[model samples]
Target: MTSPAPAPETVAHDDLCPICHLLLYAPVRTECNHLLCASCMAQWADASTLTRITPSSLDMDLSAFDPNYDPTPDLEAGCPMCRTLTAAVPDRKLAGFLEARYPAAYAERRVEEETARGSRVGEDGVQGMMILIGNRHRAERGGDEGPNKHNWTFFVRVSRPDIVKEIRVNLHPTFRPPRVVLTEPPFEVRCLGWGTFTIEAELVLNEPYGWVKDGMGSRSQSLELSWMLDFEGRGKQGRVRAKVKKLDGDADHPIDVDARASPVNLPHMDHQHV
Candidate 1:
């Protein structure tokens, strides 16, 4: 018989037995998937224990390690993938190997970990009364479709019908010298208006900025008014809302105010109005 195709070379776990080599064991694996005896491995793993490999160093070893206990430490319990006994373990480095080798498993672990912590909700809903504004625009009032040269005045009125005190108005930065006028209690009101004109608050006869912009631009200015209702009560809360009313008849109609842009006639004859 042809010399049996050289019997596949085989390695053993105890090939370099620490007992015979007189060195600490460094566990290694075999081709047949058997663990090797490492001389250095045993020494490092059990360095703190009272285990003596060499008789001459017995005194020091006895003091450090437990003499009665035989420490048999395995680098790893078993193969992570196959769950079978392996000759060697990568130890802490095993995480990287497993993640690269098994992406699906790694992802599953991450998801499981996150789920165990808690669920996340993006935002909270308002339980008490709160006001939100939007859709503000501006343009010359009444005169013509094109840009006007008249100044406009827009009035915003807020009615707080609650036992509230100290209301704050978060006016948009663009509101020229935003002024807060307090009128009445159990209902605080403020008036703010501005525009470009020479006389009293008047609307421009034509679009002022329309020359550079088509149908888009600052057709109206925006103002954001927030109210900080400081009222004391168990269930009493205040609500705020704004309505833009034309203060000057120069504009065809008063611009309904929102948290967006609104058109107001520019002031005219500043010297006389001031």
Candidate 2:
């Protein structure tokens, strides 16, 4: 028979991007404090915004008017959906303005781009864990239905040496998407499935804290999650661990998962992290 897959390599520390599961290229932060792929964040935001807006048909009544509303205020931030902060934007307000403007059909382009990047992963062979996070739906052209909402999902599996544990994982979606940067640290995105449960990760810094300069100083942050799973081995039980990091060029960041529970009989349970 063919050789089995090798065990995951252990590194010094978990330093990869949780979103892209790669190196943090240009990082951005969410309101609840989670990281994302800079470019992916940008597309998600743009798509969300385009899906949220509906053009007036010029045939409505006076009740539709809000005296306190100003069209200028709505355009205040560029792509309100893409809300992460970055260094290239010295004037944060300016970036928001640009995002609001239609950049030659950016939404469609974003979907295509994301699809191309996602086509690189392989298939899964067994039962796994999936986390559906958030999704955005952009409005289709020639329509007044506004933007449709899409949901994002993440999947994880026990590849090598399965074990047992009662641990849980959580992901918070209350924060707005962040802006994409170009010259800062990079992040990673782990592919945990074959069909539709893949997620992109980024290094999002909490508000009032700010981005850290490379080689200067490091910032402490944690990703907010919302789900957990109880894994139990069917045969001889052991230990397993899950970690996050960024993915560089052709190099895959290593993951170590060890679980332990004798006579394993893991009954799956669902719980959200507070």
Task: Give candidate 2's TM-score.
Answer: 0.20
Q: What's the TM-score of each model vs. the native?
A: 0.17, 0.20
Lowest summed lDDT window (length 10), candidate 1? 119-128
Predicted candidate 2 versus true structure: per-residue lDDT over 52-158, tens digit per residue: 11222323322354543211111111322344432111223433433344233234334543465431110110111111222212222334664322222222222
Q: Which portions of model 1 show Cα errors greater than 4 Å?
A: 1-127, 132-139, 142-160, 170-177, 181-274
Which structure among the candidates has the greatest TM-score? 2
Reference-based lDDT, each prediction = 0.26, 0.26
Worst 10 residues of 2 by lDDT: 119-128
Q: For every candidate structure, what is the RMSD over all alpha carbons to the true structure, in angstroms? A: 32.2, 24.1
lDDT (tens digit, per residue) of candidate 1 on 1-274: 6665544323233332333342112333433354333323322222121111111211122225343222233322333234453224313243444456445544554454336421111011000111221112133344665433223222222221131212223333454433332222222222223333111111111111110111111122122343222112211122221111112332432323224222322221111112
